[model samples]
Target chain A: MIPPRFHGVALAAGSAAGAVALAILGLWCAGFAPLAVITTWCAGAFGNGTRIALSLQEAGPLLLTGLATALAFRCGVLNVGGEGQFLAGAALFTAAALVLPVVGFALPLALGLGAAAGAAWAAIAAGLARWRGVPVVLSTILLNIIAVAVLGALVEGPLRDPATTAPQSALVADVFHLPVLVAGTRLHLGIVLAFVLAGVVWLVHERTSLGFEAKVIGLNPAAALRVGMPVAARQMQLLVASGAIAGLAGAAQVAGVTHFLSAATTSYGYAGIVVALLGRLHPVGIAAAALFMGLLDTGGRACEKQLGVPHELGDVVKGVMVLGVLIAAAWAARRSAAAHQGPADG
Target chain B: MAELVSGVAQSALTAAVPLLLAGTGELVAERAGVLNIGLEGLILAGCIGGFAGAVLGGTAGGLWLGVGGAVVAGMLVAGIFAVAVVYARVDQIVAGMAVNLLAFGAAGTIWHALQDAGRDSLPSGAGFDRIALGGPIVFDQYGLGWLALALVAVTGWMLAKTRAGLVLRALGEAPEACAVAGIDVLRWRFAAVLACGALAGLAGAYLSIMRTHSFAPDMSGGLGFLVLALVIFGRWRIGGLVVGCLGFGLIDAVQQQLQGAGAAGAVSYRLFQALPYLAALFALAVFRGRGNGPAQLGRPWPEER
Candidate 1:
């Protein structure tokens, strides 16, 4: 009994370690990766200075996406198209930056406006799900295609950077870029905001009556309605919140990291699904998962540089671990359910 | 306009061929009460496996071999999914997702290995030769085109006419009721989902080999998702499903046309590409998930107690 309790507290950690072990098994399957290289991949991710910063910096946006997915999913919304919503958010940010003339100390205004636009764009699909009973998964994914097309249309047409002769949007003014936190550190203000948001999500879910409502709706829609909750309104609000968080994630990616928009380079939105799932849909868990994934991502690139294992190898490892973790969760859930069957009524 | 219209029709036919195959397979699978969500990943895995086989073996008949290889590869991948969700009694949706993630990673590993090995004797792509019907309208399509239409007709007939189809439909419509009737519901349902996986794989092969010559990693894009949506929009009707395929094809084609017509930077272009999904939404709006979706779409049937 004592051992099981010990294991219970360590359950999430132990399973995560097991997932890593499974990933090692997957790598070994190829018979191409050498042991020294794997060691180097891990070391390079955490041992050095700049590398760690890049990992944390990258995780900032991913954490937001992860949190967005977790919130929506916890509310019983399956948002598979966060990638598209993210791209649309970037597009919205770009559109806003271009339309609004940058004035002195107008930096905050620009970023805030961009985020609202991003939220509005995502709310379109959320609205569809609310009004029409369209599955969030289907609508979001479809919107993803539309997002790509819109970005494609813009880059190829009016938003085309004529002077540079590349299909990049007009770079947002330097004044609009968020201030870096520590001069030598890659820690930007965005990372801080992500932490704050994570706290806010936790508080909203734990403290407020709204949290109970969201949980009820997610757990059972019919039950929520019978309980006199405005299921539709809650869903709309949750959808918008989910999209806005995802939008900020994409906006942060653009304003924080790339500083330029491209349909091809980034996909933090979809990657967030993996993060959220890995984190088990808990806000703090998402933060940790995003950072871990960000470490793996950084490690993957390092492996490409140091060991010739290719960046895709890291992606392979990620995909494998995700499956491993999910399968374990499924079995665990099933077992728990079976265990609680009241001893078969004696 | 007529010339453009004809061209759009032809393009839509070409685009819709694989979707018709995959969507029909998914239709059958869902009709038996399982969502089979790993379809996108299944198609990718099938493409990679089929591509690997065709490329590794310098066979003269690449298309036939590729199609066969895809079916086997697809069924094998999907078989793993069936075991996890069915026999293991895991959540079908999550199992489908697990299969997808595994397929995606597996396909990536294969692509990297093949590319690292150089083109070598691995046969360069030129599969699926077209049968030119001389004059114009109905005949000069590729082998897959004719096969797609044929498969649609056959599936439609089988679904409406056959005893096996009735058993499958019974499992779909009411698993408990069918099990009470002593039907081997689990086995039949497994067979249906496996069929869906194989057909979807064939469609993936069509994309890499027939549509485009070179096979890129994760080449199915989200066509599988679109086909899944089509299952809804089609209201599970075979004919309507095929029409839905055509409709999606046209939407895609029109989006490209608009890009050609200089709507490139416009947000409307994004909305344009969303046309099919919106159409799917419109469908759910009109039908409201009542008579629209399958009766027992995501549940797995149990064996006799």
Candidate 2:
């Protein structure tokens, strides 16, 4: 039998293989050759410096959002409002950047405020869950619609770029732009920060007492409460922290890539949940999963351009992968339970 | 003022049809213990499926074909969700979310493929004609609207009076007890999910064919989630569901009218558009702790050998 420590690694590898196989099968059903799709996907995702840079660029927001989801899931809080939190951060960041004087420190200050705005937005759901007995899952989903509406209103009114007919905000000054890590490529320092933040998250989650308390709450809330842990307070804190991380992702997207707020931004928050689940809610795993999803995004576009495949193929693959993980995890849990209880229980 | 009032009322009925259909379906599923969060995706799949089928048939009869395709598409997607949640014992919420993503991607890909294949424009007059019910304009509606109302009545009766309804409700509250009594809890739950998918699919078809006359990506929006909230707001009863749906529908209809009345500059139309969602959120907050949800809701039932 395989050792318990390697179970995570084994599951990851197994699910990854299953995902690839399933994607190939799906492509074949759509009339594409399996071998050609595989080659094309690989080459498109890692073909050149520019391609890799684009993939990493896409991975940045995903990494932050995935980290947000991971932290929340670890604490047993289903914070599905990552999308709303991301939008809140982007909206606040844009408003702050448009008004604040162009300075080196202004960028960080605006990002901080954006994160705070996300935290505040998330606190509303937390408050509702704590006091009013509303489910965070449902409330956050509703809040996402409201957040979108708010963003739409802002862009068309206060944030409207007067110079253009388009319904989007004015671009932030170049001083607020994230510095390029590669001189000739679009790779920005935001990705570097994302990597650093992932490491920090991993350290805190694995080493800190706070993380321990959160995990206990996740595994069994009643047991944690019995142990005198402040369950509600910790859940509220983790949820806010989760929102802040997702908000940072939105803020980074504004300063690093888009430079303005618009209604047509990518659904990074929703995609991040897929990443977190695929990564098994572990920090390092989330980082890798983020990159994998980034590759799918880039490669899917490449297939669309080169072949006739749709770019949405990436979403299909990601969805299937997460489902595969869920099934595998459940099976593993049952198997281990049976093993622990010996043959008689089975 | 009478014309305006009737116009708003007519629009409210139109808006409420899709919600009522999907809400009724979700109510049954929730009562049977499966909270299918993938309702949005199922609706989206139905939109594309119905649109494609209608386009293929290219006649009045295509409307029926479109609806059939929608029901089939919705059930197909929900089938995956059912397998994962009911058979594989996956977490219902996570499985539902995955199903949503899968449906979203599949529908989008199919739409793009259709566009590429030169099926770009939607067929004109692809919807059912309004039938007069012997009153004002408010009494006239598409055949589906009347059918939706009938569905609510039938479902309410089925839940209240039928042995099948009792078994279904029992499956939600105490599956273990049902299992002890030799009931196939898994099979019943699976069927409940499929039924929800079919109804949600019908709702989607109503949106595309009867209401909007065209399909757009993610057109179902958060209507599925709103149905979930409304189901709760109604206190898990048919009467409550109808009242909640009509209330939200009136708010939506008024919001649209206000937007069309050139209130854009004075008050942003986005705020009006957000009213239904905000109202639902407020209702949820106010009606908290008054839920009559099934006891086994969202909990996966592990089948014993």
Candidate of highest TM-score: 2
What is the lDDT for B244 in model 2?
A: 90
A83-107, model 1: which lDDT tens digit per residue?
Answer: 7767766777776667677887566
**Which window of ten consecutive residues has the lowest lDDT sum in model 2 chain B?**
B120-129
Error of 1 at B102 (Å): 3.8
Best by DockQ: 2
DockQ of 2: 0.77
How far residue A67's Cα lies from its native spot in candidate 2, in Å, is 0.6
Per-residue lDDT of model 2, residues B1-305, tens digit only:
99999999999999999999999888888899998888889899888888888788677667788889889998899899999999898988878888889889888888888888888555666555577788999999988888889988998999999988998899889999989999999999999889888988889888887777778887888898899899989877889999999988898899999899998778778788888988888888888664478888988896423
Docking band of candidate 2:
medium
| Global lDDT of each candidate | 0.74, 0.87
- TM for candidate 1 is 0.91
Q: Clash number for every model?
A: 4, 0
Q: Name the 10 consecutive residues with the lowest summed lDDT in model 1 chain B.
A: B119-128
Tell me each candidate's i-RMS in Å: 3.2, 1.2
Candidate 1 lDDT over B34-140, as tens digits, reads: 88878888788778777776675555766667777778878888887777666666556655655766677677767877888884233644445556677654345
